[model samples]
Target chain A: MRYFLELAYRGTHYHGWQRQPNGISVQEVLENALSTILREPTALVGSGRTDTGVHAGQQFAHFDTDLTLPDTLIRSLNGMTPSDIAVYDCFPVAPDDHARFTATYRYYQYQLCRRKDPFRADLAYQFVFPLDVPRMNEAAALLLKHTDFESFSKVKTDVKTFNCRIDVAYWEQHPNGDLTFHVRADRFLRGMVRALVGTLLAVGQGRLSVADFGSIIDARDRKRAGRAAPAEGLSLVGVGYPDSVFTQRTTGPAQAF
Target chain B: MRYFLELAYRGTHYHGWQRQPNGISVQEVLENALSTILREPTALVGSGRTDTGVHAGQQFAHFDTDLTLPDTLIRSLNGMTPSDIAVYDCFPVAPDDHARFTATYRYYQYQLCRRKDPFRADLAYQFVFPLDVPRMNEAAALLLKHTDFESFSKVKTDVKTFNCRIDVAYWEQHPNGDLTFHVRADRFLRGMVRALVGTLLAVGQGRLSVADFGSIIDARDRKRAGRAAPAEGLSLVGVGYPDSVFTQRTTGPAQAF
Candidate 1:
C-alpha cells in the first residue's frame, strides 16, 4: 500500500529536498529514518524539490510498504530524524496517487525584513531599502496576464514549456515594517518565485516601472528579469491535494502521551 | 564614555550569555566583535546571564570607551558580529548607570506548542498535552503573591536572596492552540522562570493542584518544585529601566531602513 507523509523541514543544513550525490538532503534523512523504524529499506518521492537553504511550512511525500503502519510510526520517525526535520503525519493513499503531479495548487511566501532582526536572520532576507507596496502590487497584477514566464524561469531546464497559472500575487507590509510577498500558482519553474520577487522589488524601488516589467515578461528571455532573490527568504507554505486522497486528518489533535 | 548597548541573540549556537571557561558564549562573541570594530580591547557587563539554548529578544550591556562614538557604530558592529547576534542600538549613559542593578523590570516568555510545528521546533517546546488554561492561570497568579522563591532557585547559586518582585504573570492561548506564559519581574533567580512553568504545567495537567503548587513555594526547598522546563522554550523578552538612565530610545521605531 502507498502512504502519504506530510512533513516540514529547515533546509539550511541540507543540500536540498532531493537526494544528491555529494551532500546530504532531506529525502535521504527521511528515508533513513523511515527505513530504520520500519526494519526495511524505504524510498520517498517528495511533492517537489526545494533548493538548499530554503524552508517549507508544509510538504508531502509518498512511500509504499507491506507492513501495516503502527500507531507509533510517526513518533518513532520523528525521534530518529534530525531536529530540523519533522514528520507530522503518515496515512494511506490510493495506489496511483502521485505526491507531485496530484497537487493542484502551490503557495510560497518570501519574507523581507526592513530592519536587522537577529531572530529572523535565518528565515528572512534583510533588505534595507524603502519599498512602495502599492506600486509593487500594481506590477504584481501583471503576473497573471502572461502564461509564459521564461523571463523568470532558470536558463537551463528540460521542460516543454514555461507556462504556469498564477492565481494570486500580492505584497503585504507587516506592522514591524517587514514585507512579505504571497504568490499562488498551479506550478512554478525552477527559480520562478525568487526571480519574480526580485523583479517586483526593483519596481517598488522605482528602478523599473510596471510597463517595463510587462515588457520584460513579454520578452521571454531570462536575461531581461531581475536577479533571483536569496534562497533563505523563500518557503513553500502550502500544497493542495484532492479531498478524496486524504483518507484521514493529516495530524491528530493535542493529547497527553 | 560609558555606553549601553541593546542587542539580541539566538542562543542555539552559543553556550549562554555569559563568558564560559570552555565553550563559546554570547558575551565572548559580542566582545570580540565590538573590540574588532572599535580597534581596542573591551569588556561588557550584561544585565544578566541566560542559560544555553535560551534566546533573548532584548538584552542590554554596558561598555566603556575613550574614542568618540560614531554614527555608523550600530552598522559597523552588526557587520562584525554573527548573523544571529543583532546590535540594534548603542547610546551614551550616565557614569554610574548599570545594566543589571538599575533595571526595574525584566520580562520573559515561555512558548509551548500543543502540536508539532517544524518552524518552531527549535524556538519552542512541544508539549503534547491538554492544558487547563484556567487552572494554569490560577497557579500563575499565585506566583506574584510571594517573593521568596527559594524552591525554584538553582542550588549552587551565590546570590544573597531569592526574593523577586513579580509584576505580571499570565498564560495566553493562541488561535493555533499554542500556549505562551508571560512573566515580568524585577529580578529572577537562575532557572526560576522555567521552574515556575514546569510546576504550573503540572497544575494544568492535574498532577498537582493549585494548592499543592502554593505549598511547594512555601516549603522553600529546591526539590519541592517541578523540574525546570527546557531552555529553548524560555526567552528574555524585555528589560525595563529608569527613564533617567535612558538618554535615547532603547530601540528605534519601525522603518524601512
Candidate 2:
C-alpha cells in the first residue's frame, strides 16, 4: 500500500529537504521517526527539495509499506519528530501517484521586511532602502509572458529544460509596509524563484528598468540576472495534485497534537 | 545624564528579563552590550520584568552615563547584541525619569492559535479545542470593572499592593482564525496576565461562566483562578510614558543595520 503524508517544517535547523552526508536534513528526520513508529525501516520521497534555511508551509511525501498501518500513526510520528517539523496527515494514495512528478503546480512566496523586526529576523529578508513597488510589479508581470526562464535559473542545474509555464507572478505590499512576492507556475527550475525576486528587487531599487528586465529574460543567460536572494526569506507555500490519486480523503486538519 | 533605550526581544532564548543567578537573561545581554560599546561598566534598569519564554514587542530601559554619547552608539550596540534582541532608539531623558516608575500605561497581548502551525510552534499557544470568543470577551470585560487582582497574582511577590487600574481588556479574532487577548493597564501583578488568560480560556471552553469568572476576581484569593497560561503566548507589546521625559528626540526608524 502507498500512503501520502502531509507535513510542514521550519527549515532553519536542517540542511535542506534532501538527505545529505554532511548535515541533517528534514527527510532524514521524518524517515527516522516513521521507521521508529512503524518498527520497520521506512523510506519516503519528498515532493521537492527546498534549500537550506527555507521553510515549507505545505509539503507532501509518499511511502510504501507492507504492514498494516496503525491507527495512532500520526500521533506517534508527531511525538517522535522534533518541534520544528510536524506531520499533519497520512492517507492512502494510488500506487502510481508520485509526490514529485504528479504535482501540477507549485506556489512560492518571498518575504521582504521594510523595517527591522526582531520577531521576523530569521523569516524575512531586511531591505531598508525605499522600493518602487509599482515599478517592481510591472517587471513581475513580464514573468508571466516568458516561457523559457534560463536566465533566472541556476547555472549548474541538472534539469533537462529551463521552460516553465508561469501562471501568476506579482508583488503585494502588506499593510505593515512589508512586501511579499507571490509566484505560481507549472514547474520551477533550480534557484528560479529567488533569482526572480532578486532581479525584481533590482527593478524596485531603480537599479534596473522594466525594459532591462525584459531584455535579460530574452538573453537566456543566467549571468544576466541578479544574485539569488537569501534562502531564509523563501518558502514553499503550496502544491497542487490531482484528485484521482486519492482513494479516500482521511486526513484531519493541519494541527499539532 | 540618563538615557532611555527602546528595544524589542524574542525571549525564547533568555531566562527572563531580569538578571538571574543561573541562566542568561535579556538584562544581562543588554548590560554586556552597553558595557562593551561604552568601554565602561554600565548597568541599566528595565521598565518591567517578563517571565522566561515570553516576548516583548516594545520595551524601554534607562541607564546613566557620564561619558559623552557616541554618534554610532545604536549601530555599535546592535552589532554587539544577538539577532534575537534589537535596539531601536537611544535618547537622553530627564535625570529623574525612571523606566518603571514613570510609565503611565502598559499594553500586553496573548496569542492563541486555533490550529497547529509549524511556523509559530514556539511563538503561540496552540489550543485545538473550540473556543467561544464572544463569551471570552464578556468575561474579559468583567476585568475592567474590578480594581483588585489578587486572585490572579502570584502568591509570593515583593509588591505591596495588588490593585491595578485596567483601562482596556478585550479578545479579538484575527482573519487567520487566531485569537488575541489585548489588555492595557496602569500596572500588572506578577503572573496576572497569564492567570487571567487561563481562566478566561476556561470560560471560552464552557468550563466556566462569565459570572464564575467575575466571582474568581471578587474572591481575592490566588487559588480561585485557573492555572497560569504558558509564558510563550504572552508579549509586552507597548509602554506609554509622559512627554516631558525627552530632551531631544534623535532616533531613526526602527531598522537593523
Candidate 3:
C-alpha cells in the first residue's frame, strides 16, 4: 500500500531533503523511524528537495509498505523522530499518486530581518539597510510576467527546462518591519527562489532599477542575476495537489493500539 | 561609571544565565565578547539568573568600566557575540542603580504547545492533552491575592523570603490554540514560575480544582504543589527598573567606526 505523510521540519541540521553521504538528512532520519515502526524497510519520496538550513512549513512524502499500519502511527512516528521533524498526518493515497510529479504548485517564502532579532537569528537573513519596498514590489511584479527563469536558476542544474509560470511574487512587510518575499509557481528550478530574492533585494537597495531587473530576465543567463540568498532565510511553505489525490483516505482514526 | 546593557538570548546551548564551572553560560559568553571588544577584562551582573534551557527576551546587566565607551559598542558587541545572544542597547546608569536589587518587577511567559510544532521544538513545551484555559485563569487569578509563594518555590534556596507581589497571572490562548501563561510580579522565588505553571496545568487538566490550587498556596509548603514544569517552556520575557536608571543615557548613536 502507498501512504502519504504530511510533515514539517526545521532543516538547520539536515543536508537538504535528499539522501547524502557526508551529512545527515531529514529523509534519512524519517525513513529510519518509519522503517523501525513498520518493521519493514520503507523508502520515502518527498514532494521536493530543500537545501541545507532551509525550513519546510509543509511537505508531503509517500511511502510503500506491505503490512497493516497501526492507528497510532502518527503519534509513534512523532515520538521516535527527532524534535526538529514532525509528522502531522498519514493516509493512503492512490498508488499512482506521486508526491512530486502530481503537485500542482509550490509556494516559498524568504524572510529578511530589518533589525537584528536574536530570536530570529537562524530563521531570517539580517539586512539592516533601508529598503525601498514600493520599488521592490514593482520589480517583483516583473517575475509573474516572465516564464523563462534561466537567469535566476542555478547554473548546471539537471532540469530539462528553466521555464516556470510564476503565479504570485511580491514582498510584504511584517508588523515588525521585516520583509517576506512570497512566490508561488507551477514549479521552481533549483536555487530559483533564493536567486530571485537576492535580485529583488538589490532592487530594493537601489543597486538595481526595475528596468535593469527586467533586462536581466531577458538575458537568460544565471550570471545576470544577483547572488542566491542564504538558505536559512528560505522555507518551503506550501505544496498543492489535486483533490483527487486525497479522495482515498485510508488511515484509521487515531487511537492507541 | 556603571552602564546597563539590555540584551536577549536563546538559551538552548548555554548552561544558564549564571557562570558555572561545568558548562558554558550566557553571562560568560557575553563577558568574553565585551572584554574582547573593550580590550579590558569586564564583569557583568545580570538582573537575575535564568535556569538552563530557559530563554530571555529581555534582560539587563550592569558592568563597571572606566574607559570611554565607543559609539558603535552595540553594533560591535552584536557582531562579536554568538548568534544566540544579542546586546540591544548600552547606556550609563546611576552608580547606585543595580541590575538585581533595584529592579521593580519581572515578567515571565510559559509557552505550552497544543500540538507538536517543528519550528518551536526547543522553544516551547509540548503538551497535547486538552486543557481548560478558563479554569486555569481562575486559578491564576488567585495568585495575585497571595503574597507567600513557598509552595511554588524550590525547597532548598537561599532566598530571604518567598513572598511575591504577583500583579498579573493569566493563561491566554492564541489563535492556533497554544496557551501562554503570562505572569508579572515584584519578585520570583527560585523555580517559582515553573512550579506555578505545573500546578496551574494541573488545574487546567481538572486534576486539581481552583480551590485546591488556592489551598496549595495557603499551605506554604513546596510538597503541596505539582511537579515543576520543564525549563524549555519558561522565558524571562521582561525586567523592569526605575526611570531614573536610564536618565543618564551615555551610549552614543550607532555608527560605523
User: What does candidate 2's lDDT look like per residue over B128-216, in tens digits?
Assistant: 78999999999999998999999999999988889999989999898768999999999999999999999999999999999999999
Docking class of 3: medium
Fnat for candidate 3 (0 to 1): 0.68
DockQ of each: 0.54, 0.49, 0.49
Better of 2 and 3 by TM-score: 3
* TM-score on B-chain, cand. 3: 0.95
Per-candidate TM-score against the hidden true structure:
0.94, 0.90, 0.94
Q: List the residue pairs that clash in candidate 2.
A: none
lDDT by residue for model 1 over A6-77, one digit each (tens)? 888887788889999999999999999899888999999999989988898888899999998889998898
TM-score of 2: 0.90
Candidate 2's displacement at residue B9, Å, is 0.7
Best prediction by DockQ: 1
Residue-by-residue lDDT tens digits, candidate 2, A1-257: 88989999888999989999999999999999999988899999888999889989888899999989999888788778887887888998888899999999989999998756778777889887999999999999998899999999888988888999999999999867899999999899889999999999999999999999999999999999999999989999887888876557665445321
**True interface contacts reproduced by each model, as a fraction?**
0.68, 0.60, 0.68
Q: What lDDT score goes with residue A215 in model 3?
A: 100
